[model samples]
Target: MTLPGITPYDGKTLPQSKAVSATNVHEARTALGNRLRELRQLAGQTGKQLAESLSWQPSKVSKIENGKQTPSAEDIKDWTRITNSTSQATALLASLRTLETQHAEWQRILKGGIRPRQNALAELDQKTRLFRVFEATVIPGLLQTSEYARARFAESIRVFKLANDINEAVEARLKRQDIFYRSDKRFHFVLTEAALRFRLCSPEVMLGQLDRLMSLSALPNVKLGIIGFETQYTASPWHGFWLYDDDKVLVETFSAGLNLAQPQEIALYATVFEELASVASYGRSARGIINRVIADLSPDDAEA
Candidate 1:
């Protein structure tokens, strides 16, 4: 598919210049769509005209411009030629290709064995200055208790057949949280209520995990929000993402994670985050939700 030229939809507004590289693939795709569309409209070219010039299907052109499909390198080159914007097209296409490759499935990472990939997580931990996370499924590694983490890690090792260095894997994840304590850095966490109710581990482990989340919420540098299920709006429909300053967005999937480094995509993600944040309860209200759960876990109230 080639990059199409159509006006950006309402959701595709560009983010601030600083966050250009800190968005997800879907966000980048939207940004690219908007830019290509702008270029095409400037050239007074319709989707069909652009497609005819590039010898691509009109539907393909539409998909590219609409952010539904990724354009190949060859497709990008031809598109630039057709639009007579070679210089800008070359650089943009190169970046687009990078984004496309980064979205490869997690199975590929597993092909190289899970250890190396886990090590990469360690490296990322050392570099990121600020972490803004929205989790829908599980407790973030930074907030997960040891018992909960161990259970989750054990499952990962078993699934991936990664029997060696389990401790190293666990340690890498735990160590990543140390950034939360660094004076120069801060963490903003927004979690859906489902994450708390979902039982990734046993009741006792889950309770401890909730307790850990409560403690983290109390930290001065942390801004924690818990979005209730009954909330009216959510930026994301299902799934969540991690924004690391203006550098990148780590969009986690079941099999693998997508690292977004384009500015446009970063802005879209930021927008979504703002939407999700708006529907969330922060400060005392947020803490009260967790506190109620903790109270439910008390000795006499074990049934809950």
Candidate 2:
């Protein structure tokens, strides 16, 4: 019922932060609208005058100031110009961009080829000093072998009817693994036992990926944890999440990806990861669980 990081075991969204207003997209939009209204009033422009001057319908201006619609980037730039509040424009635009990007629909973000998405990840990947990943569906992309990655991308292509740009996308993802070799970075990965049972790839490919996981487990800077199926967890493994140090957390859903940057929101994911990690076994014990999953994929398993 739970996805891992987003849902509780009871299938509810956990209210992680006390300062929800700071991160709520709706609130951000409304605040921007109210601020615009205040600025318009300060400029001594009535709705009709401002709309006429800006070549906008009165209703469009009214809706924007009433928080019924979000302003486009260009609209905000021009709004500041019309209000003569150029000094505060940068900060306002930055907040607006953050709000929009955080709530961006996956369809819109993926309107271009998958390669761009993969490349965008590379931008964030290289700058990350610490990577903490929790997965409940399949192997984390950073830890997946090339064959395993291709299989996953194929499913994506089918779902989105995207161009068969699998080669470039996979290659870009593979390039991100370079971070795995960097001694300056640290990675902590945790996976639920259920993730191992998902057969996203052929048995041979999954086995190979499992082997790569074991090898990565031995890395001095990497810590891999596998929570056994029987283990009693301290907290729910709700949804898959990635924490980039203490600064950001990325939570993906069926519809969109959430970029949680508020300090409190990031801290909440860090806390959930810790709770999950506490129940997960590492070192040789973690490898033992992975080996069992590898064995489960044997031809004999199909017969049984």
Overall lDDT per candidate, in order of appearance: 0.74, 0.82
Q: Would you list the clashing residue pairs of candidate 2?
A: 3-238, 3-239, 4-237, 4-238, 4-239, 5-238, 5-239
Residue 222 of model 1, lDDT score: 89
Q: Give Cα distance to truth, residue 21, candidate 2, Å.
A: 12
> Can you write out model 1's per-residue Cα lDDT over 1-304, one digit (the tens) per residue?
1112322436644223333322355667777877888888888899999988877789998898888887777777787778887878767886787666657666666555455666776687678777788888888877877678788777777776755555666676677777777788788889988888887788788888887887888888988999877787634445678888878788766666677766656666676777777788998899888877666655675554
Error of 1 at 266 (Å): 0.7
lDDT by residue (tens digit), candidate 2, 261-297: 8765676677778888988999889988998988887
Residue 152 alpha-carbon offset, candidate 2, angstroms: 1.9
Q: Give candidate 2's error at residue 125 in angstroms.
A: 2.1
Model 1 segments more than 4 A misplaced: 1-101, 111-115, 295-304
lDDT of 2 at 185: 93
- What are the models' TM-scores? 0.66, 0.75
Model 1, residue 203: what's the lDDT? 77
In candidate 1, position 235 carries an lDDT of 46
Provide the clashing-pair count of each candidate structure. Answer: 8, 7
Model 1 deviation from native, Cα RMSD in Å: 8.2
